[model samples]
Target chain A: MSAFDIYIKSINDVLEELKNSGRRINVFNVPSSCSELPRTIPVNIGGNANPGIILRQDTYVELGNPEAGSSAIMISTNETGLINDGRITLIGPDIPESADKSLPFGQVILIGGASLDDKEHETLQQPGFVGDKIEGYMIRSLPQNIWSRISKDGAAKGFNFECLGKALIYLYKSENPKIESMEIIFITSAKDDVKLLDNISEQVRKISKEITKENWKIKGYDIDCELDCSSCGDKSVCDDIRDVLKSRKKKGLVK
Target chain B: MINIYSQLMSAANKSLFGLTLGPQNESDGPFIMGNGDFFIEIPVAFGCSFSDLTLTGAMGTGLPNAAELIDKGTEVGVESRLCNAIKVATYYLEAGLLKTPDMIITTNSCCDAMDTLGNLLNGYKPWAHIPRFNMHAPHSYDDASYEYMGKQLRQAVKFMEDVTGRKMDMDRLREVCIESNKQCQLLLEFQELKKAKPCPAEPDLAREGAEFKNWSKDRISPQVTEWLEILVKETEKQVKEKKGIEGVDEKIRFLWQDLAGSWASGTVLARLQKELGAVCVMDYVSFGTWTPVDLSSEEAMFTSFGKRFLLEDPMNRQALHTTDLFCNDILQIVKDFSCDAVILPAHIAHRDTNSRIKVVRDMCHEKGIPCLVLGIDIWDKRYMTPDVAFDRMKTFFEISGLL
Candidate 1:
């Protein structure tokens, strides 16, 4: 057993308890094996992607919509055992089932490979690794979070969690050769489930952040500020300018 | 990060460019961006010189009525395709916003935009009678090239003094040159300070330091050098304390080549900082690693001045010179500062830089550095909105895996 076995087991245990509690759960096995997964970069992006914006009028369904509340859980483990090679589990209504509804989204991707390590974690989880390859999916945020839009055209072409699961499976496995097994869970059932996923994600987000830090550290970087520095960053004027700023700040110039 | 940095910026803001900006008729300084050791000899460099194009560009474009000012420039048969900053400057002279100078020294350190603009400034009805000396710069660099430009420097001194009736003081000029060398050394030290891990300086600091460089042109006043000294001391303290910009995380360090012309509404760095931990570590204006002047003799001083004019000056060295200098400048900064990416703000008017950007991108690719070529006018926001720039940059960071 590798380091991620416990994590995979915990995820399974949670899902099993949810399933036993009468939550609508559907399990699917990808039609193709990992080796035969068709690889594709989204035709819409064409390598040089502008911010993919699926407008409100053109939208089929929004997942993890910032307004609807969103949480994402991503973890990769070297323990290839206890891994369902091509399984996608969906909770609540499917993508096609919801015509124009916003869902409190929970997306969890679990990867297991015998050779997987920390360094490859970033590449394996790059937005392109998921968003770029999935034909109908457009992610609107950075990694570790997903505020995504599925197009009406994509839904017309029979896009749903089953196909999304298969698309992402093909996307990830085809792009990364070391990956031996992968599993994904999409929960659009309730805000409570999304929050639960956020709670469960603490351990994985910490690990992903460390991977990011390690990679940047090798290139001689230290992430500097964690606060709202952009507000103070631009207003860094001095002398008479600073004096004016001080006066304005006292008079409620800026929050 | 430093306490005195604002003071330095304040001093820089008051350089030769601003001397005539507001309703100031008593000011004597006339220095602009160009002129090295010979810079002060131009009669205008008697006190202040302004550097950073970003600060000047920001001030020009952000003027609440800048678009109207630009429209006014176009009204006078000036082409709108010309750099917006140059157009604004043209409008300033035409509208009497800038007072007619006693004498104006026009050297084309930038490109062809200056050629037409120079003609306008030189022939403007009110200032046409004044002693207007068009300083000549050579295309190549060599010993004879230095001597060739050096001779012209002497002519400019004679021209300015002959008109102003002030004798050229050799000893005082020498003293100013020596002091100028000290300020340059301190600036070089400040450049080294920026390369620290976590980048002790923020992106705007480089933008601010670009203007501070011009403040050093006030050779007679030791105050500019003192400001530089405070900059170095404060920056050194920041480094020793492992300090960085108050609110920057610096996850990504990028070199902003050709950020010299203007700030793109000052949005790129802040957005990049807030969205990603990307901080602009260095830019073309802030990157000055020049060979100091010999300062031994007055003649050599002119020669060194000529060398620096073509070889060492901020925009002139890279923008006016060969494609090799341009590529080498980008690659050198990338390595020296350990930058992961390069943002070439392919401002529309930079025909010189825009033509060579392909070569630059290819070279960056060879070195495993991602280069983003953004096609926008650095001086004008209407050409490409700040939001569009943000989208492109964010996408670049994502696709390049910097995110």
Candidate 2:
């Protein structure tokens, strides 16, 4: 199967564009399963063990920071051969080569498996963005636009592209066993390149937005109102209350 | 995993949802406030179907017409400066949006908005003919004061008997008291779990259950108690696993002292957590602070209710009584919860809490706990939007070196 859901654009276009972009791109292939990756970083869920810390003074590099430019996306397809199992592609400079600098970063994770469905796009997204889940790697809020830091300690410990890629591979493979083929692309070349990734990410986000609401429905959260604000006069004011309450309801808060 | 607060609140709400209207119970049909109050117990003990739409109607800011309803209330007679909660409640009551009750039991240990609202409902033209009883709370907290309120509660029971033409089941009320005590115990255990490092729960979750605060404690059902049991277990599991709010690094932990707290759908805290790894460890609703009531005698039951009424209720504890309780509670929460800062939301309607803000802030600062006073209404976002509150906090964090 070559064409699958959530990949509104063909995967070949991404490969072709990266090859023609004149940027240095390196591909490192690893073992297919998480158990085979180097034991450099384990899955640290619930937050960075030392949160909001690793002060700016302690960070050697800030990637895809909002100040520079930030873009990220996780796209999945059930097509065979579309994803090279355990392949990590770095389209820009790696950590040791680009220290003491803030760079526009772009990350795109391509996953492929026969059992993958469009409904689980968010479930796929959850573990793919390894925030504080990786040691000494602290990511600033929400991953839709990824901004992260590599602590000085982490860099000194040889936490480079290979280690980072291996950590990602470990987390994705461990959390999602059904993922048969996974390929990651990291672009720290230019803001324009990150924007290029963002443009492609938006198409998938269109489908993502709908599936997210579907996920909410499964969790017993709904609009909770009969009136369509599209026709109401006080839609703007009600919209604020509606959005907040909807989230609260998702958490099972009382009326 | 679902956070501790959401699990418990959902369990608390679901356990009590349609409780009085359940197939197993007969209906007397009473209307009461659902602001986590216990006055619903009188009707609940009598097998009454509680049709309280206060929260269901206007107080649910989710309702599309919430703002419209509040505005309508202002247009009628309510002052524009009044709380949006009471404003919308007034409009809905006048509009007959909520189902009318056979009898109304109004308790006023909380605030003026409630007291005035009770007064209006008691004398309102449409509801005037409805048999009503008032438990006017006095400011003093002595034996005579509790005796006065307890006497009112007894009279309220008599009034209930006179209206429903049904005799009070002493045994059922006793059983309800016993169940309520169990809820208090479970609540304490649940609260104790929050003191865990990394705070194995969400901030807003701790900001709920105000409805379970006082006289309303007697409305505690086995489901709520069992749910609380489950909540304790769930939180315990999280603590054992060393779990905390997902993705939060927890560099900073603070206590929120808002009257209604931040109802921004977690936007405020979510931003703080994402940007700074800052977490709100506890809020005013953090603890089930009240102890179990004495049930050895019928008179002790009502007197305990009065004690919980004046001493445990938010309004009586912080709003009406001395500023000492207000400052003491804040300082205590800061130490108990291991917080780095405090956010005291200055709700516009809570002038009493607002007036004592300086005292609370100075005390917190003197103890090296950074305190932030925000000009926002916790229940009504129109006063200060979530984005604005978040920006203020971000600035405060920067100034306080918590960034």
Candidate 3:
């Protein structure tokens, strides 16, 4: 299976179990700044994408209108999470089978990040971003909050899940992925979460050995974790601790 | 003056023909008439010395009013006041307003002014070009920039030589520099004159020093040299006797920021200095000239570029960094000089970056020094003329009681 397709399958399995358990859940898809990486110039171009706005892109319509039997789940993406097309996709499932396909939805709202241009003389003269909001297919902005959050607890806090959630949103906004009574999955890039997948896989092994529940059975799969800092495989900013360690060793402070 | 006119009338003066001079007032007229081609308007720099004549081309039509010009165009528009100045110079040039100097040399101290003038001259004829040199604002004095500017001065000398068909004569240059130093010293003295309870010199003299750039002219020895020396002696005597100049008013002191005179209310600042009893003790241009110590290099071209470009780097860095070092230096000057307040007139184009304002305001605020931030343009006076701007400033000052 393709990499993103495998990701989709694994995440669906987790979501399916969560849905059957009757807990309300949300998934946001986001893109990594990798694709927009500049050919020249030392400055990173990816920070321009605001994370909060990306999470809210397709969820704007869902936030506006409410339905009787429909549960709302927002899928967001960032960095590696974006689809081939620039459009960020969102997928919402209707509670009833018939209402799923035919539900009328509001317009897809796209959220861009904070822009440097917005910090213009007049804009800076005011309190915030000059109340000059952007609503379009492709937008630009600085995700200040997201950068802070990622900086603090990025690797340990299941950030891969959040990153994948953002990507899922991107896919849905593009392909408009449909979810029915089938199982849901949660694919992630965290090593610890991948170990949790081992637990799920072990549980699936036991369930397969004996007779299990009737409705939602999670046939387990482990989350794949690939860490490549040089090429940027994930959306979080990894501390270049290796450099600090190497410097220490070189200085004879550490082995 | 009439004898010189009569003498010129007898001889065939061929210099005024091909120049298209213009837009200068009638009182400053006929100085640049010749037998060249077409004399468009008035020759504003006719009797001025050669180097002074060089900047005469700089005299262009001031925009009618800021509001009318801005109203006619979009938000981001290039107002061509500088272009009109160059064209005026060109009109006189073609009409032989000058003795027909071969090349044009332009300096960029007035931001868009010289840039526009240079481009207009180049566009008029491909060969007719002014090599662009930038003047550092007097206040910005970093060591590295000073060194760079020294090199730029050397290079500017070469440029001037090429344009004026004259070699860089060190003796002549030293003479010019000494003469120019006298003017700068006079200005410094004038600045010091403000210490008097009622200043001895008119505050408007400072404005004339800032705007007209009389120091930049050649032949500085004759008129200004003699006049300023005598004035300095007279003003010193008057000050010793505790006497004030007649027709002069007392003024307070303030810091000025983001006051580039274009498409904005320069009149506001002019008026504030007048009616509000406030003298701009610290300004971007006044503080920007922090010259370098080590500019002696063998390669004249590189040294010249380094000098001019580095000095100009502060203005260039305006887009990136929030607070300009030049502004910071002015703030330091404010603290040291015991100025009352810093008045910042940030207009639409310059308001986006809050670096300079942020630093100055925060520093001044923390120090408990009164700093006023005014949002207005320094050049375009469409919405308000000098009188109206002065009136508003007077009201503001009276209400604040800083006067």
Summarize candidate 1's per-residue lDDT along B255-332 as a digit string, tens digits. 878754445525766788767888888778777755556565778788988877777767677676656446656765
- Candidate 2 residue spans exceeding 4 A from truth: A1-255, B1-38, B50-58, B206-219
User: Which pairs clash (backbone N, Cα, C closer than 3 Å) in model 1?
Assistant: A224-B249, A225-B248, A225-B249
Runs in model 3 lying further than 4 Å from the true structure: A1-255, B1-101, B104-166, B210-219, B243-251, B258-324, B347-355, B384-403
- Residues A1-255 of candidate 3 have per-residue lDDT tens digits of 021233334444654654565543444433323332122212111322322221121221111111111111211222222223233322333212221121322111222222212112111221112111211111211110011112112222222323423432333232222211011233221222223334334333233222211111121111111111233343233335656787899999997
Q: Rate the local accuracy (lDDT) of all candidates.
A: 0.65, 0.64, 0.35
Question: Given candidate 3, what's the lDDT at residue A69?
Answer: 15
* Tens digits of lDDT, candidate 3, B136-250: 3233323345456555555545655554454654544444444544554454454444344454544444433423223222224445555455545555665556664353354
Quote model 1's TM-score.
0.57
* Regions of candidate 1 where Cα sits further than 4 Å from its true position: A1-255, B1-11, B14-20, B23-38, B41-59, B213-220
The TM-scores, chain A only, for the candidates as listed are: 0.76, 0.76, 0.20
**Can you write out model 2's per-residue Cα lDDT over A81-129, one digit (the tens) per residue?**
6677788888788998778999888877778778877555566664224
TM-score of each: 0.57, 0.57, 0.42
The true-versus-predicted C-alpha distance at residue A158 of model 3, in Å, is 77
Error (Å) of candidate 3 at residue B275 is: 5.4
